[model samples]
Target: MSVRRRASSVSLSRYARPGTPDYVTPPGDFCNAFWGLGDSGVDVLFARMRCAMTTTEELMSFWKERAILEERYARGLADLARFTIGKHEIGEMRGALDTLKNETAKQAEAHLIVANGIKTGLETPTLEFLRKQQQHRREKLTAVDKELKMKRNQEGYVVRAREKYEADCNRIKDFAAQSVLLQGVELDRLRIKHQRTLETVQANRRDYANFVRGLQEATQRWEDHWRAFCDGCQDLEEERIEFLFNNVWAYTDAVSTVCVSVDNSCEIVRLALEQLETEKEIGAFLRTYGTGNVMPDPPPFIDFENPDLQYDPSQPPSSHPANYPRQSHRFPTEDAANRNSVGSPTLSINARRASMTLFQPSAVNGRNGTARPPQAVQGGGSIPQSPSSQQRYSGGSNGSHPSHPPHAPPQQPPPPVPLQPQPQYPHPQPSNLSTPAPAHVPTSALATAAATAPAAPCPARTYTPIFFSLSPVQAIFGYTATTEEEFDFQKGDIIAVTATPPDGWWSGELLDDTRRQPGHNVFPSNFVALLM
Candidate 1:
């Protein structure tokens, strides 16, 4: 009974225990029963699977969207690359065009230089040749005239020699005829005469021989000299002609070279112009793309008017105011309010005359119209009182109170006579001329004593106090002795120092160690010493 009761109690306790499986319920069956309710549990599982599938589909759609964007980005990148390549190509073409234009221009310039050189070379030789030819012609003509004059003189000398020879021969012939007819006393006389005739004949023959010899030598010399001169003249003429011909040839060659160079230069210029046109076209094209419009053509020539043409003196002058009045035109009458506002003199002619009357006293009584006292003219001339009169007149005219009466004449003060100092003369020397002993010793030895002589007390060395301020930091470091050091002090610091010699005091900073601060001494180091 106790065991059954214990068993019953254990059973009851086991049955009463919470969450214990009942003996009639199988675990598999219970699980099968709960799972078999497809309406709720299977619906929840299907819903979870459907949500996960939807998420996967959304992920796939997102990937597709990303792919589309990536593709579009790739296409854009390709387009940009193509654009960059196109720009690079365009730039390269432009550079090539510029280079070609520059090269063409350079070639044209070089051709022009060569052409100019050729032209100058051609012209210079031609001009020189012409000058030389003209000079040579002049020289040849002079030489020919000189030679002709020498020939004429030689012919004259020849004629004179022939006349002398003929006379001598005639005299000899007469003496021979007389000798043949003589006999007796005549024979003796004839013999002496014959001897005389023979002597005379001999002398005549010698003279004739000398004359003939001299003539022959002169003729030979003249012929030889003339022949040599003619030969020289021929050679010179030939050389000059040859030189001219050669110069002509050289000139022609140079001209031909210049012509050819000019032709080539023209061709080069044409080509350069074509290149320039092409470059301009390229520039226009580039500009069209850059600016979205064609550029306007520049004017062929600037229209400038002559600056000197603006003034036409031939035309009558404008009918403006002639000899414009000194007073303001706005105030036409003296009674106008603006009349005095212009500050111009409003006195009438009679009023000016009346003012001049104030000088009657000086003009009547003063010498040279000067009102100064007679003694004031010590230097032999009178001082003019015109300036004084003018001063008084001007003062009265421009004074604030225009209605005041004219100033009375000032009384002339007596001129001061400078007292001439009497000339001091030395006392007459005594016959002995004895010197007196010196009473004072030299002061050089007493310099120290003089320096120590209290300096006349110096009036207490008075100094005016000028207060200065300094920051706490600056006070710690002490005041800067100079303005430069003060300026260079750290930001928080302040400087205070007494500036001496207080009159007209000014201070400025020093830029460098060598630069002196105002009223300060620059030292060898970076320091500046204040000067009192």
Candidate 2:
């Protein structure tokens, strides 16, 4: 193939001829023939290259969008998995919920893996390729344009030389025509001028031919360089297509791998689900919430009319009230006669009662669970007052028990009825023992009264004078608890003064109340008035 010169303009017939189907054909099927077209052709070549670069850019954008999609889907799924609400589900249902949550998280991870693969294996390389191509295209295009400018300058020089040669040939013809119409001297001068122009025309013709040859050589060199550029560009375009095709396979494979991963992830959830059953859950529910299935039997009825109750010693009671008495809620009991006995306090109320029993010296026997009257003596004797009672009376508080002694059994006993009466004195007593006496009578006055009254048979006494037993007393005034350990009571309340220790506080109980509530607290000594 060769370029042909024309009288008017240059022809690019050589490159325009059809060539092999490979190489430059694919890269510039429309632009390679225009390589000889100078600046205008440069525009065409770069435009084709730029289109290829644009395609790679578009591929990169596609990958970016896909990455974004995968990333967002992963994030959303992760949020859904993590945002589990309440735990009302239990047992098997709870396990199922957890499995579902894990399944969602696994799916999210799969999406994320796809996203990461696309970003690293596809988008990043495409983007880098675009950057490199863009740079190389610009560099190549600039070099091509620079070479084109130099070629244009050389072609211009060739045109100028051709114009000068044509003008010189026209002057020689004009000189020859003038010589035929002139005289000897005039004709001779015209010939001389024509001869000089002809020589100058020959030199100009040679210079024009040289300029044409030089331009042809220069054009060939320029075409060679431009051809090298196009060939290299074709190879680059091939590389771009090959790279893009491989990446397409990678993208599809990554998406398909997500399916495999999802299948694997769901397998875990399936396994968890397979283990659960409604029956198992129901059994657990029953175990958690079951009550008894049988009703308890109600107590049997009894006939009140001549009702015969038989004592059934089905088994001995765990304890008997007569045996292990309660300690905290009741005043402590003691055996006055057995202080040195095991498990006994050294000093106690029973001890006081034992040391202070009041009776006729002739009567050796005294009160206990059963009261035996003092045996009567023929001689009249003084009624002895209990030292404990005097202490209670002198202390300005009512007596802890009745001052009356049991009546003598229709026997020979006479007495000086002196210190106190059998009942009406303000001496405190256990109300359950017998009919009670006036609660506020002064003991000293009662003693005087009893000293004059006829010695009528004393009322029968039911009081068992067990030593250390609680002796009932009456409170003349109200008392309130000031601390957690103190007891509260109102006026006219009957209290059993169990102890009158040296400490001002004394312990007792409300014997008058229905419950017979005991006072665990120690009260002020002055709160009650003992009989004198």
Candidate 3:
């Protein structure tokens, strides 16, 4: 066949022109088949190729639009999800805040109650009455002391009167002694007078002792009351302090929890937004087809005319020029490569073997199993050994043991044990003589057996529904008990719902034990939301 070659850039019309002998031979059967159909067939094929390329461009546009729409839709959904979650979180936080507020208020009320107790102890009526009574007792004691002193003075006056009377009686007795019988009468009068005076003095002393006992008793009772009042005040103060501490601590904890929850919500939102942004950015580059302004031209052909394209001396002797067949492979054969790879002068396989041999368990010096020192290789550095191997090698290097270094010289390994011929014996009979010989099983027999095995029935799972008792239900919503048996609970109180009725009422038990006894309560169902 005759052929004409032309530059690829030449116009197609020149080749198709009649009377011009620029006929080019087809490169292959495919080209020949298309060429046999002449101009129209080739034109139709080219038109079809142009249509296909146009369709591909439309497809690309459609996919790009689809991706953009999908991204928009996904973002919308994500935004909706985030909004929904944010709303839910906000609701939870609100509920938590409300609960915390209620709790704080309740604590404050409790603190007030303690404070009242402390105040009452300080200025209580009972204590005041006791103090007044104590004061009155002291006055009574002072009055009694004055009365006793007066009685003592009166007794002293009577003693003085008796002494004077006794002196008169003695003088009368002296005159009567001179007159016999009259002396006995005078002496008897004097004796009776002295006994009366002694009796009066003894009565005054008894009255004084009784007054002193009464005063001491009053003082002791007053002291007891004072001590009791002081103790009660101290106790109330302690209780107040304890309540204050508890309230403050609880408030602090609630605030901290709220802070953590807020932080977590913020982080979740940030992460979701970041993910959406990253996906939107990456969606732009998903399809790289036809993105460039112009496709790059093929790498400039070999440039055979260049002066720098001199023969490479390092290349294999059989390397061929472009357009020429290669007669030699680039890499050595696998077996040859493997054989020389380890023993090559650059690799130093012998040194590695020497290092490994120095640490081998069996190659030891006698009883202690010490490692023999590694001999120096042709390379400058000693072979690197593990710490344990180095220690053993160091221990044996002292020349105390008769062991040779690994690289000192090559030595033959001990010959393997020779195989001994065994005496022929009949194989043992099968354990089950009556049973037929077992058939051979395939390698997949175990798997097949498992696959064929009947599956066990799954046991039914018992799911226990968790019941939530509202904590601080009233603080979050309104609730009123309709029955006499139902207990009315305040804020920060636990309300346990036992059942819900269709009548817009729910039957529940009050768990707030402080103000009311725990019992059933009927309240509107809408009074509280169900906790998740």
**Model 1 alpha-carbon miss at residue 203, Å:** 3.0
Q: After superposition, how far is residue 335 of candidate 1 from its true place, in Å?
A: 85
The residue pairs found clashing in candidate 1 are 183-187
CA lDDT, every model vs. true structure: 0.35, 0.56, 0.36
Error of 2 at 123 (Å): 2.4
What is the TM-score of candidate 3? 0.19
Q: What are the per-residue Cα lDDT tens digits for candidate 1 across 34-138?
A: 122212322332233233333334433443454344345445433443432223334335444444444444444444443444345433444454455445446
Output the lDDT of residue 141, model 1.
38
Best of the candidates, TM-score: 2
> TM per model?
0.25, 0.46, 0.19
For candidate 2, report its TM-score: 0.46
User: How many clashes in each structure?
Assistant: 1, 9, 0
Between prediction 2 and prediction 3, the one with superior TM-score is 2
Query: Which candidate, 1 or 3, has the higher lDDT?
Result: 3
Which candidate leads the pack in lDDT?
Answer: 2
Alpha carbon deviation, residue 21, candidate 3 (Å): 99
Worst 10 residues of 2 by lDDT: 390-399
What lDDT score is found at residue 16 in candidate 1?
36
Q: Is candidate 2 or candidate 3 better by lDDT?
A: 2
